[model samples]
Target: MSLLKKFATVASGTLMSRIFGFTREMLMAAFLGTGPVADAFNTAFRFPNTFRRLFAEGAFNAAFVPLFAKEIEQNGMDGAKRFSEEVFGVLFTILLGLTIAMELSMPFLVSTVIAPGFTSDPVKFENTVNLAMIMFPYLACMSLAAMMGGMLNSLHKYFAAAIAPVFLNFILIGALLLAWAQNYDPLQIGYALSWGVMAAGVVQLAIVWFAVRRAGIKIGFRRPKLTPNVRRLLVLALPAAITGGITQINLLINTNIASGSAGAVSSLVYADRFYQLPLGVVGIAVATVLLPELSRALRGGHMQEAGNLQNRSVEFTLFLTLPAAAALLVFSEPLVRLLFERGQFGPESTLIVSQILAVYGLGLPAFVLIKAFIPGFFAREDTRTPMIFAGISVVVNVTLALILFPRLGPTGIATAEITAGWVNAILLLSVLIWRKHWDYDAGLIRRIPRLIIAAAIMAAALYFSAQYFETYLSRQAGLLVQATTLGLLVIGSMIVYFATVFAIGGASLSALKGNMRRRKKAAATPENTDISA
Candidate 1:
């Protein structure tokens, strides 16, 4: 399959998952609002969720896929299977031990690391501890699932792993519905949701596990041992894990600092979820597909192919990401109000969340670009450099967040995050260009400014459109009227953006079609990895 086609497959799945996730958040807003229970639930889930991103999504794949691809190239399927089993054995044992230790230390972790501010409120603190302990085991399941997902991606069977995450939202949404039906209190609902998260992890893991089996790699557990291969994976993964988890790391920082204010954590969480829609769909899909493809190209000594992959991925990233960022920046308040300003989520909450979402929107491009760039280093087995850059970004985030939070509150923390994000992205891109690892073709250089212009035009249109539809989007309007008006505004803005983009040569139908179409000759020749064909 062509690279663009692979991206679409993964993106479609991610989009589905994000839609379900959006629904889940809306339900949570109605049920818990930005209350103590909401804060506790978000905090509980954040621990496992952060580690899941750190290990399963980014770190494990950065280290494993290249080596696994190399194993296939040099030693064939048998060698790949053996390598996978070795890593699995060690990973499972470590995750088991880590979960046990974390469970035992849950109270201390909640008080010190997770949310120190909650300590003053003994009930909230204890609830957080209990919820975290129930949910922390999710990390083990997801880490194992991520390993299987890496295998599926390496084998070029992308859909299964891509679709696996949808289950998390599905299970959580079901739990929310049950709570609403039974009319559970906030604390009871929090427990139900935490248990739902734990269940989702198992379901997600099972989905990928079966997918890997169907793909003909049955990864079995053996006694844990640190063989050379496993040892090397560890070395590479430790830093990659940290680098991969940079967003969550920043969030953790924000959480610790923002936790001092009531409703601050929940506000940030809502805003983060809104921006994550674009980031997850575009950024993650690119990273997931780009890493393996780039790794294989570099491994096969196809420098031109590697360079083309990077340039095209950036083009793709900006093409989708820029406009989403524009929309968020221009229409944040209406969007927030439309999505969440019902029930307990009031106008005050909407205003605060919108402010934070707008700030996050400014960083959206940088956030997605990081996904596009980091694979350049990981593809070449250079993890430490990105890890170092991640550390610098963390420092920037910590310093700025501390300075700004006192004055700006949640928005201040968001400003620091975006600043940190841009720093990390610029540093990664600069190193790639300086080292001659990334090649910028004329198409990317030319289209970037045009893409920016196209997005600017769309943002202007959205700004006015929101004003024109102000009455319908206001609280006086019924939910149906607000939803319908918002949908039209979004659809209309998208039409304007795409028309302007294609007309201005920012994006081309012919080029996208050509990239999506598989060439007969390239398909006949297995060694030809030229993505442009």
Candidate 2:
């Protein structure tokens, strides 16, 4: 399949997941609000999520996919199966051990690392520790699932792994409904959601496991052993783990700093859910498809193909991400208010969350660009370079958050985050160009400015449209009225953005369709293997 088709496959799944995610967030806002229970639950969920990203998705995808793809190329599916079983035994054992240790130390972790500020209120602290213990085991399920997902992605079965996350949102939404139906208190609702998270992890893992099996790769459990393959995976994964979780690490810092203020942690989490929609769809789809594709190309000594892949990935990433960033920047308040400003999530909550959402908007492109650029290094087995850059970004985040939080509050933490994001993204791209590993194809260079200009025009249009609809967006307006106005703003902005992009030559539907046509033709004729867009 063509790159665009592959991206669409993954993105379609992600967009569904994000839509459900928004629904889940809206429910949480109405039920839990930005209360003590909400803060504690958000902290608990973030803890396990941070570790899952660090140890599972980012780490394994970076270290395992390339090696697995190479094994398929060099040693066939049989060799790849053996290698996967070996890594699974070791990964399972490690995850089991880590989950046990974390559960045992849950209280200390909640007090020190997860949310020190919660210690001031014993109720919040105890709730966090309990909730975290219930949810921490999710890391084990997800890590195992991530290994299977890496296997599926390497085998070109993208839809299953991509669709697995939707189950998470679906299950969580069910939990919220149950809580609401039962008329549970905030604490009881938090408990339901925590258990829901744990259950979702198992369901997600099972979905991917079945996918890997259907892909004709059945991995059996074996005694844990440190074979050459497992050892090499560990060597690469350790650093990649750090590099992969850079965004979560920075957000953890933001959460910790924000925890000192009541409702701050919940506020940051809400705002984060807004920006994550685009980042997950565009950035993740590009990264997931690009890494394995690039790795196989490089392994086959297709240097020009590798460069083209990198250039096109960047172009595609910006084409989607630029307008997303523009929408978030221009309509943060209306979007937040329309979706979340009901029930306990009042105007005050909307104001704070919108402010933070706007700051995150500025960094959305940088965030997606990092996803696009890091694969260049990972496909080449250069994990340490990105790890070093991630370390620098972390330091920048921590320092700036500490310096600014006293004055600007949670918004300051958001500022620190974006500043660090731009820093890491610039460093990654600079090193890629400096090493001649990535070349800015003239097409990419030309289209970038056009994309930016198109996004700017769209943002200006959205700004005016929001002004015209201000009365309907106010707090006094009914929910249906507010939602209708916001929907129109979104639809009109999308129309303007796409029209501008196509008009200014930022993108080409004909070129995209032709590229796909060529890919399909190449697939039919095995001898015609060149499928460049």
Q: Which residues of candidate 2, in runs, are more than 4 Å off?
A: 516-518, 521-533
For 386-428, candidate 2 gives per-residue lDDT tens digits of 9999999999999999999999999999999999999999999
- lDDT tens digits by residue: candidate 1, 1-533: 77788889899999999999999999999889999999998988898889888987778889999888988988898899999999999999899999999999999988889899999999988898999999999999999999989999999898998899999999999999999899899999999999999999999999999998898888877899999999999999999999999999999878988889999999999999999999999998999999999998888788878888888889889989999999999899988998898888999999999999999999999999999999999999999999999999999999999999999999999999999999999999999999999888776788889889999999999999899889999989988899999999999999999999888888777667766677564221212322221
Question: What is the lDDT for 325 in model 2?
Answer: 95
| Pairs that collide, model 1 | none
Query: Which segments of model 1 are wrong by more than 4 Å?
Result: 521-533
Task: Score candidate 1 by TM-score against the native.
Answer: 0.98
Lowest summed lDDT across 10 adjacent residues in model 2 is found at 524-533
lDDT of 2 at 289: 92
